[model samples]
Target: MGPGRYRFPVTPLAPGQAGPRPGGGPLAWIRAHPRACDTVLALAVFVAILVGAMAGPHGPHGPRFGERDLTVTTAVLAAVASGALAVRRRFPRSVLAVTGVCTVLELLLETEAPRAPVACSVVIALCTLAARTDRSTTWRVGALTVVVLTAAAMLFGARPWYAQENLGIFAWTGMAAAAGDAVRSRRAFVAAIRERAERAERTREEEARRRVAEERMRIARELHDVVAHHIALVNVQAGVASHVMDSRPDQAKQALAHVREASRSALDELRATVGLLRQSDDPRAPTEPTPGLAVLDHLIDGFVRAGLPVDLDVPRPADALPAAIDLTAYRIVQEALTNVHKHAGQGARATVRITRTADALTVTVLDDGTGPDGPDAPEPGGGHGLIGMRERVEALRGTVETGPRPTGGFRVHVRLPLHTTQATHQAGASGRSCRTGETG
Candidate 1:
């Protein structure tokens, strides 16, 4: 309501009701007894001024009040100024107005001393407002108060316009505004820092969850490749052994042995997959080898026994393939063969070819039989087996093409870039080797 003195809605403690628990802190005490606290503060300001009036230097060894006891009017003015301060925090603008009027009256009327005590209390109130509010409000209100009060002191005071006491009033008010604004700035900075830290923590949690989901999808793909291929072969061989057990004993025994080997391969791959989940505290993983393109012959051996003849042609590079690409290629072949077993009927012949060019490694699997797919079937990412191959290839920025072959079967073609992937893998391995050597 007054210049810069914004009125805060002070909710007083309810009558006869116990407030917040005592000893909660200074803030709690003030809230619990707002009126009482304001009274104490006002009285303290009055006493401090009274002491200054008594002990402060007077005109050439004369009484500050000019040989007179405290006059009734002067005493009343002092009381008014002190009492107005009781609601200074709740109504700073109003308090400043009341105290400003009182100070001007003291300058115009009081004879012996014009350096008023009410002015000091006004400075304290202005400081509180600046700290709680914005800079524009504080500066506007503080400037208006300074110009009006300083001009009043010069025109109607006992002292001259250039008096040291007059200048002191200007300096103290400016200092109060500056100090309060500094406090406001500090609080805002701390709040911003806290907000940023909370947001970063939330982001980290989201990233961790995303990585976990990606890992789960990868593991499911691997299990599908290992279990599906081996289990299909084992099922077919078991059927063969049962069929021949009565007619040819030697043939049945051979088929039963093939079943045993297929089961064993499945278990080994499953264990290798499960080993990835072991914690650091667990014993080391089984030293069993992972499958790769180099093992294509042995892989074809199992399929040949299952009655699906496979032709494998893989030319080994002078330098081995990156572990990831090698493993992915092996899986692609395995999944392709499993699909042939499931979809292509008897008399199917599959040809798996791995060819390396200047920039890429290509893999193609073609099977001829009554393959269970139309020419319109989707490629790569849209289907199950093709989806796994697409995900693996695309991770390395490679490509996959799959569809029903016009000649009479299904065809899968994969091409993976070698230069970038192999280089990165070599750098990583080199770094690890250097670290190991240093540790030794």
Candidate 2:
């Protein structure tokens, strides 16, 4: 309301909400509310100035108040200026501009003796503006305000060129603006850091989910390979047992035994495969040795017992093979024989050939029976057996090819790296010669 002073709202004091004594006596209650603190401070300074004017000078440095109309006008203006400061935070820039203009006009109007309280209002407004705006804008606004007020005081006021009152106004207003701008910058920096931390946390969660999906895929592949090979073997032996039941009872009994063994093996492996879901505190699961090239003889014997005519060929002094290579070779042979059992009719013949080269082992399983084009050929179930075999060989850095042979049968060919530890040991101690190498 006054030329240089601020006006703040003064609601009736709520229960237990009154402030401390004025003039720095007890500032404890004002500390709880900063905006209220600013308003109270402005009011306190104005009241002190009013009281000082009325009491007159005690020392040589004290104020000299005017009488009559000048006194009345100054008092009214000071009251209005102090009152405006109550809403400064809600409209900092507007209040600062209005209060600054009024202070300059008042200095000019009261040329001989301007009021000190009018200058205090300009300081409170400048500080509020700095706290609400960015640093660059605060600097520009604060500088212009200080310069304008100092010039107005010097040009029109009754005060001397270096009056202490005028210098105090400049010092107090600049400090308030600087302090408020510092608080603004610190709060912004803290908020930016919190945002970055949240983003990093989200990225970490996404990476964890990707890893879980990849692990699930690996487990699914393993289960497919294990189930296909064992089930095929059981089906072949059961068919043989049924066909020979009356005419060859002893042979039929042996075939049934092989069927039971194969079924049991499948159940055990399936349980192990699915047990990955068990909780960590559960008892350690049973582990089974993976089938490798060394077990080819036993696998061939099972097919023979199931009534398929069989011929086997292998080179002597087999070279060592990598563990992955050995396992891949075994799986390829197992899958090929299983396909032959499923598709080949009664009295069909199969030949398993294993050749050793300096660098790799080559296996070929050929069956002379209804091939893919044959009308009575069995429909492939699940469709994953061949794919699983191919995947296994590829994992070991090997290759496999399967198709109908020119001789009216299906042939599966696989090449696996030898010189593996298992092959070397099996070849060294036994010194066994290769099996028969002629076509059946």
Candidate 3:
């Protein structure tokens, strides 16, 4: 009834199914067939009542049977009281009412010497009702059964008001209600624990899926940066080699060499990025260190060689950036420059600037070329370069600004925190595997 406490319906087991009973035994079989158990219980109680009714401890020598005659009325009342118990679980309240009425009749009719053992069946039926129904209903029904039966035995029977038989009926009925309530409480507690465990398992599985998705995105961004950057340089160099193959033999050969170098670099990076998918114990896994500001010069040289002259300005800071921030900054600069080379028209130049503050490291890339608004702009969301950049920066809780400059050309400004959280450090470690390669 409380929040988040859901009660699911139980599904019945099919034939030959072990169900929840993996180790089947006597108790397991009894539990699996409730109606059969109830029937057996009812028959056993009937025999017990009849045996007790035919004997008494007031015998001359000791307790003995055959001293008192078993009358037809006594036999019929015992049979009726016990028979109703067989269907107690299906109709618990109705069974309890029938058993209680029979007990009252047996006590009232035997006025000369009352020895009604039908109260045994009433006790069993009351217990069944209490176990199946709620507390309020159990209290009301149990109290009524006890008061009625005890009053009948004391008022109409030959026994005194405070006789042991009258008191025993009240005690048995009260104990049955208490015992049944205990069983119901224990069952509810166990069910709640199982539901909690199942919910936790579902949460753990969802978290694993989320982590997998994040890893895939990280690998994708790394692959895009590596392939897009080097391939653009390769395409430019190959075109130059073809354009001046005859007129300028020396320039053509130099461009061919640059193309070879770019292609080799692209292959090495591709191999490293794909190697992340391999098992950790793989022998051919790449061990190359990830690129950052330390290799900015090498990255710029490749662009300058591909006919895009670039100006770089970076000041050394007091402390180094965190691995994640350093990697993100390097990738952003790489991606922004790659975009410039691919979309900017001929004779366009780019400027790269790095500014370090107390808490942040900012990298700005500006190109004096056709911006996104120009005819050369890629369609919105069509380019994965910017999307990858945004994802990387956001992962480290950084910011990225990309738009056209006020005067002309396109600009990409990114601010990365020098000191990142522990979660960012862990992400950097995971991503390091895919980013490891030779950038040259």
- Who wins the TM-score comparison? 3
Which residue pairs clash in candidate 1? Answer: 5-93
Weakest lDDT window of 10 consecutive positions for candidate 2: 431-440
Give one digit per residue, the lDDT tens place, for model 3 in 244-276: 999999999999999999999899889988999
lDDT of 2 by residue, 1-440 (tens): 22363433333322212223346434655555668776786688578546644543334676454441336655765666666787787778877877777677677666445645577777877877776778888989999988888777666654675776677667877887898787676656655554565555556667556545544644565576567667777776777789899999998898888988888878876787677667757787656565677777887886676666679886665555655666667766777777777676666799889888887789899999874446745565447667666655554446677888887778888886554465443332122222222110
Where in model 3 is the C-alpha error above 4 Å? 1-19, 60-63, 135-140, 156-158, 371-381, 418-420, 427-440
Model 1 bad stretches (over 4 Å): 1-43, 46-113, 135-145, 156-158, 357-360, 372-384, 418-440
Q: What ordering of candidates by lDDT runs from best to worst?
A: 3, 1, 2
Deviation in Å, model 1, residue 237 alpha carbon: 2.0
- Lowest-scoring 10 consecutive residues by lDDT in candidate 3? 431-440
lDDT of 1 at 115: 57
Taking all chains together, each candidate's TM-score versus the true structure is: 0.72, 0.57, 0.85
Question: What do the candidate models score in CA lDDT, each in turn?
Answer: 0.72, 0.67, 0.81
Candidate 3: give the clashing pairs: none
